[model samples]
Target: MTDERTYWFDTMQRIASPVLHSLANETLHSDLPTETPPLKPSALLEAFGRTICGLGPWLGATDIPENEKAVQAEFLDLYYRGLANGMRPESQDYMPIVGDHQPLVDMAFLADGILRGGDRMIDDMPEDVQDDFLYALQLTAQIKPYESNWVLFSVLVEIMRWKLDDPAYSQQKIDTLLQKMMQWYRGDGIYGDGQNVHVDYYNSYVIHPLLVDAVTYYSDAYTRSIRDVVYQRAARYAATLERVISPEGTFPVLGRSITYRFGAFHALAQAAWQHNLPENVAPSQVRAALTAVIQRTITATDMFDANGWLNIGFYGNQPTMGEGYINHGSVYLCNTVFLPLGLPVSDPFWADPAKDWTAKAIYGNAPVPRDEPVNY
Candidate 1:
């Protein structure tokens, strides 16, 4: 494997092993550190679901190297066992999917994982486990999401339902939520978190990724135009994400969920994974940029605890960086940076020669293309 790919896979295993291993062994509740007891239940779901979301594409790919595939097989076993344990009421690590508002968010991440993982996430599981998994996901219908980005969460869950042919899936709900999202579009590849604009990474963190994935799955005459516009905006926003990465791999760190680290590039990573990057953004440049960010962020001294669970911080263990809603499990969203790992090693994204990203080129006085805003 190339160094960047190796580093990404190794780091992913490092971040995910503890959560999946403990849950698979039914020891997650006891093993995971819950500095904030009230958030513990939701936090557990956050870790598992978000980890799967980031790992889904990689998990589903069939053309990976043999060594990587072996490791993937191991993790797949743990994922199935973890799912069984997390949904079983009798198990100590059982995660509640039907309570409070937070599960609405994480369940969407779980659903996104299933969607990205494709058939591998469901088709390979035991029938009983599959039944339990779908049942747990269906329970999210009881929790009403807020009108903001949370709307996309519900949309994603429904999309997953549609993909699985679950009877509970509602096309009406998906269409309705998607229409609401269109109203929030503030032009220039940006969407207000809801009705109002907020300067944050939620666009990358939640809105764009969810909308793009949702419309991609449920495409029809009703969604065809929406898909065209969403993908156009997504490509534009992805270009913006690429430009923001500094030569040192640091970004502006503007936003509420700053503690999610490299997840700020979810749109960029997803673009590469889907081969949807704008014509101006070379896949090799994106690979270099992302590899730099991953190194800078994960190398922080206290990014993880003694036991390997991620700590809350933009840089290190800066608890002050966390919002009231942030918790240990929440930081696992950083795994989204690994989305391109879903592509095969032979794909140009992995095999191409490295090149400087926009920022790096500008900082080094190298000739670069003119920057322009997307008029869409």
Candidate 2:
């Protein structure tokens, strides 16, 4: 872990520790900069989702190295305590319904956090807390997701429910949502944000990951077939994303949620995690591409506040980059970039020697292949 690689993991810990350490201990809202946001409760849920989902990969891992485990163990332990309190009827981080749709939006990521947070997030928790956690998730059932990407939030919550084996939700609910996403599919690995096409990364950030994960909970051939198609779509999408990285690691700052930062790569990183990257994209290449992006985004900027909670900007304290809905929690969506950490120390994504990313290879006079689109 020398030079670039060294800074990556070290910076990951450094940048990530403050948010996880603060939130897991129930002080994130206080310690974090909620400088603006007319809607605090909804903003709080946004913070919860962005932060927790970003950490999903590392927290969900089953084989964390002992040395690193010791490093994260304290914050990890406190996070469970924090999660338990978040569900309590009264707490600083208490969950709240935001309009008819917003709670479902944030709860999806809360469900995502529990799903990806691994045993420490759920199974290893004290029994009563686990029961309370399940009950807390159940309360989300009251909220309805608006059409569009919001649909996957409901699917995610139900998948968590199914994982709990609680059977609390009707299978039809999951089926209907999956069907809607498929309806939104625009072919060649792209799905419209919802009923209308939007120019953004929602397909990568939300749709693809949820599609890949939710489709797995069912055993039916139809579901399995959809998963296969999704993996294919994801592979192509990941490849496209790889090429989008500039030689210097920057990407287009288009569309909403630009404050989500590297979280824009959630689908791509999840593809790398599942070893499902397209055949044309080498695993090491994707790794290098993403590492560069992470370095460019997370390590190279004054992205954090004085206390280390993330600020609402892509690079620095540019509050104007955040939308009206944006808050401290919403920006933590950047954590999704860490999904590759779920790969084992031995996995090729981590183990492979670094290679030139597409942009670098081309600019450095190295041979690069022409990009192509797949019918899938």
Q: Pick the candidate with the highest TM-score.
A: 1
Give the per-residue lDDT digits (tens) of candidate 2, residues 248-358: 889999898888888899888888887888877887888888878887786546787777777878887788988877777777777777777767777877777888888
User: Per-residue lDDT for 1-376 in model 1, tens only?
Assistant: 3988998889889988998899899998888886666446887788899999899999988988776988899888898899889888899988887647898899899889878888888877787877777787688866788989999998888877677679878888888888998999888899998899888899999988988888877776667878888999999999999999999998997979999999999989999999999998999999999999999987788988998888889998998989988888899999899999999989989999999999999999999988787877
**lDDT, candidates in the order shown:** 0.88, 0.75
Worst 10 residues of 1 by lDDT: 34-43
Report the lDDT of model 2 for residue 117.
Answer: 65
**What is the TM-score of each predicted model, taking all chains together?**
0.97, 0.92
Off by over 4 Å in 2: 1-5, 37-39, 98-100, 217-221, 299-301
Model 2, total clashes? 4
Q: Report lDDT (Cα) of residue 40, candidate 1.
A: 69
In model 2, where is the ten-residue run with the lowest total lDDT? Answer: 1-10
Measured over all alpha carbons after superposition, the RMSD of each candidate to the real structure, in angstroms, is 1.3, 2.1
